[model samples]
Target: MFDLNTLVRPNILTLEPYRCARDDFKVGILLDANENTHGPALSEISETEKFLELNRYPDPHQHELKQQIINFRNSKPNQYSEQPLEIENLCLGVGSDESIDMLLRCCCKPGEDKLLICPPTYGMYNICATINDVEIVRIPLTVPDFQIDSNAILNKITEDPNIKLLYLTSPGNPTAKLINVESIIDLLKRSSSKWNGLIVVDEAYIDFTLPNGSYSQSMSTLVNQFPNLVVLQTLSKSFGLAGIRLGITYTNKKLSKLLNSMKYPYNISSLTSNVALKATTKEGISIMQDYVKKIIEQREIVLNKILDLKYVGKNLGGKDANFILVEILDKFGKPSNEIASKLYNTLAVDNSVVVRFRGNELNCFGGLRISIGTEEENKTLLYKFERVLNELNA
Candidate 1:
């Protein structure tokens, strides 16, 4: 008999991934991973040089890349602090996904410990936890607003001291809610006036929060005071370098070095590092900000149109991120999986139109999560959505 746990890690022996990229056709020019296929593909000479590096092993310690991320985030060394955060507090991994898994291995023991996740959040955290033999305790967000509940979270953690990690998504996935900063500060202060273990804050969509990141920009500064807190930022969403597969974690020196030591060396490639360096360069920030401004403008236009459609119920979130989560209803108003199914089948006929039906929703079961694309593309989705809604109503 297969000693199943040995083949796959104890936690991951049986795991189901988010149904992203249902097939190759759903993956547009490899954008599913947030890569820039438009990035310069190799010229003849450039191709030859890159091929040479492929022969040698990647740099075990991603030194050059770590320096680049440190400079870009401007962590510490602000006007308030004379000393910059030590370089040892920083390291690079294959992507934020890699960091997520690595941290679980470093902290959570197999089969005995548990991790907490607030649902309608990122799926990867759950996936990583299960594979590590770590049990997942879910705290579903209440309806209408997908806000975090500090009391509920604390109660669960207090009950299970085995809770080693708390995975949170800010500008949360699908929902787009920037969790209350004060609530997070309270979490840092939870228990004996404090807590420990890993707290991974995924800021994947922080770029999309608009009118200048009004809600959560200052929340990150808490890292300096909390030794257990770790923030995962990625070039994927904001820097437009998701293709580089570059993700960053901001934590104290002790945790950072431990994560670095545990990961496979040369996890971050030279090509990826070079691209990430360019992605965060001063010039790059200007371009990214420009794109962000356009996307936020486009996101608003899309939200208004979604509200206009009879099929879409109230938008699910507080409306601060690039994408919006809205409910889809049937004629009798029972949870409408059929309507979402139709949207997927119709849009997928051609790869141009793609919106995700938030699947297996426990609390927000009938919603669809839509990303704002080009002006024309947004209109295409709106038009198709309205037609489908009218048809479903009939």
Candidate 2:
């Protein structure tokens, strides 16, 4: 029912990937691809930069980094496979953005195929679909709880033969709610007939979930089990490596190879690859887990403190991610966008304690999405928010 060849675009399947010089040779005089050989032209460089061989082209295939990622994700409690994930199972990107775009390009024929999304989800899914000339069919999540309407979505999938991708976010952005695993399994099992495309699960904030780093809630391990499943992740969140701009895609070997074929020749830079290598190591993961613990502790403190304020209404979403979404109330105690806007501006411009105002999003009236910061930073945000809310309400 789920055929890989039929799902992918005819153009992409026949694409001849641009071959990089490094794919063939790595040693000897290295005269193949034009290079300075004299090293970087900077007047001065860091001691670490000196050894990176800045003049040479980075590896076209990052074998070492990919292996590290496989080992890290396959740690106990997560059974990715009996054989475990191999290099062919992964595809690295400049960010998850690249892979997201590539999936649209590789599957959807411009102005023909469609993408299905649940509302109050990530904006990029819509943005990317638009850029690729693909239509978007939005089915808003059920009100109050913000969970997926699995039955409704399945009905649509069964009827629409043109829907090529279904994007689901776990620990969803703005909402922070994780979709029920059984619900997802149902979608995967039932949507095989008419909707013959991939079901992409974006788990950017999954590591921030409770019992940090256990990864029991992640759908990445299911990649091996389902040919049509794709899971996207990044080093930006839990690993504290946003500066390197690395993202990962996990899928069946055929899809992974297709993505690799369609991507830029050297998408991952040397600097990014090196930093990510260290961060994916056992010691690096331990350090990251410790930081996640602190963030969760602070998240609770912020949630309890904000709810006590008169102008702050009840929470709008789950507390699964690093951020919390709470409503800002008016003088009459109803959700108010005017008050939320003023507070958002005053906190960032005057108090230097910034948080996002997401009142405009569906079912998120007068809402503010606040990310958990360090202890001192969280304290400053709560103090400023309370002081400002009172001044405006007074």
Candidate 3:
């Protein structure tokens, strides 16, 4: 029996979360929350249509928004024959960051419980764990390829039952490698015991993994089979709605209910939901698909251009995401962190073209992460990168 209550912290299990004023009543003067009855002070902004409800609190439920999300994700071709998900299977967060923090808060008992993570992956998992006072057990991914060591992870879980969550970032950050679907399933099957806890696969960049914009490879459909699995995705990357600050987590209804209960009543504002609703529509999805196609094309172009340069070493990882990771080689034909740092600084400060320097990450020594941009932007980045390389090599 995989009991979610057993995995969660004792305090969180019984604690009543803070109820926002909107919970009591949303209409009739709305004096519960104690807002300015006269409305916001900004006269210039009050005239705008969006600010008309400045005095009233946003809807805490966001039922309509979740339905739109369900429509968008379920519209994709599903690999498994499981029943379609309802709004109950989804939880909205400020971003993937909020979801991460909440998971730690609800499960891991600070100073007692711990979480597992594979490095050369997302940094927020570690950061959030630290902030929540939870210990992080680092199991670095295999070098060069940056794949998770599943066997080691299993051993770690067996050895330490205190590990409440395991974070796996697919199409990994800095590395941009996709952990194989089969490998993920294998982990899920092996970790079904009472000792092992939840597995969180952050698919923030999963939309860019395939050129056809098909999410058939996503593990979202397997949530029913493995109730312990949680898939986190965002509209920030592929939908091009980072400014809206919305993210979705697909999991079993039980866990989703727990997350919803613990999360802020009005976690997602009306404005963000309105914008996200439009972005998830049929026409909006079509626009996003078109954008993804162009970005994939640009990624290939940028990859080819970078590989053609003499100073660029072997490209790292599987290149499943919209970004590419490559090593910067020194004059002696060796990966050099010194050269990579210099090139990164020069491109950003002098050429006004910015890319992340991931030389400090494990197996990412002398690595630079370059995101695919518009054609003209890519050209500018390529030109600046080449000029910087030449100057350094000279």
Candidate 4:
């Protein structure tokens, strides 16, 4: 018999994704992935009701929605003043997930190619790279705060010219810290002339960083300024349209064409496109801004409550986004894997609450990536945590 392992890409043969609902469906008013709490409503749909055709294939170009976001981001001034980026350099996706898959297909050569990733970050980059048979070179954060060491990345890139893509998550997963705008800019400048591949900036959480420390001011502007840059933005977060599965990738025209070609012909359904359009309205998007601000406020509350608890030790929060990465301590003052396991069971069975835990392998992020729920859920978590604290203390 032929060797099957040889036939299958080594990276792809053993891949696992985090266990969550298959799609966006989770608990009430999802803020887990930083989606807007408010969902879509058809207040202005009566006029388009008759024209709404579900069976027809959506415009593969996505001319209208792309321009809508372009205008929303105030990107008109870069292109023709009146025309405002009608097409070419911008493309939409089913979600950032599909956009990620598209990039791997378009760029990476199986086995020979590589992608640079920084972890205590999103896992999808690893998942997609593995599926594509692309090697992933991971450079973890230098410290517990989860800041990237650009020098290490630059050194690695110099050694391995095969690095075709770089995947970085801002306000990174689990750690919930901003991977320094200045750090990214410096890296881009040092590597741009030499590294001719792609730098995909995942701005899924950029919305939450509004009014400060975002690519909107620094790196997003670089897309128009630099040819090698690609900004991957998702309406799932700020637009509250996770259910619609709409995301945008911004780059120079050449790369944009490649993504358009490799992507599924109708990656975004008609329903998804129209829903995304509504979800990204002037008023609706602002609502998300307000909503994220509120969630951040609640995140502070949750962080404070957890920090006050004697069982809770140092946490991974404070830079950006809504989730808190908190470490639980044991009586002997070692890692709280046992306590966390016990608390997870107690919270589930006794308190009807749930929290996540990371293993020692993910040493930097070995704690619950506790999302800032609504005031009620936050309070309930606090209550459940307090009970666990009491049990542990005794």
Q: Which is the leading candidate under lDDT?
A: 2
Summarize candidate 4's per-residue lDDT along 310-376 as a digit string, tens digits: 7777885444766777877777655577776777778878888877665343554236667778899
The candidate maximizing TM-score is 2
Per-candidate clash tally: 6, 0, 0, 1
How much RMSD separates candidate 2 from the native structure?
1.6
Q: How many angstroms is residue 102 displaced in model 2 relative to the true structure, after the best TM-score fit?
A: 0.8
Worst 10 residues of 1 by lDDT: 1-10
Off by over 4 Å in 2: 77-83, 211-215
For 277-346, candidate 1 gives per-residue lDDT tens digits of: 6666668777988988888889888998788776667777756677888778777766577776676666
Give each model's whole-structure lDDT: 0.69, 0.87, 0.85, 0.69
Q: Rank the candidates by lDDT, best first.
A: 2, 3, 4, 1
Q: RMSD of each candidate?
A: 10.4, 1.6, 2.0, 11.0
Return the clash pairs for model 3, or none.
none
Q: What TM-score does candidate 1 get on C-alpha atoms? A: 0.81
lDDT of 2 by residue, 282-349 (tens): 99999998999999999999999999999999989988999999999988998999999999999999
lDDT of 4 at 352: 81
Q: For candidate 2, what is the total of clashing residue pairs? A: 0
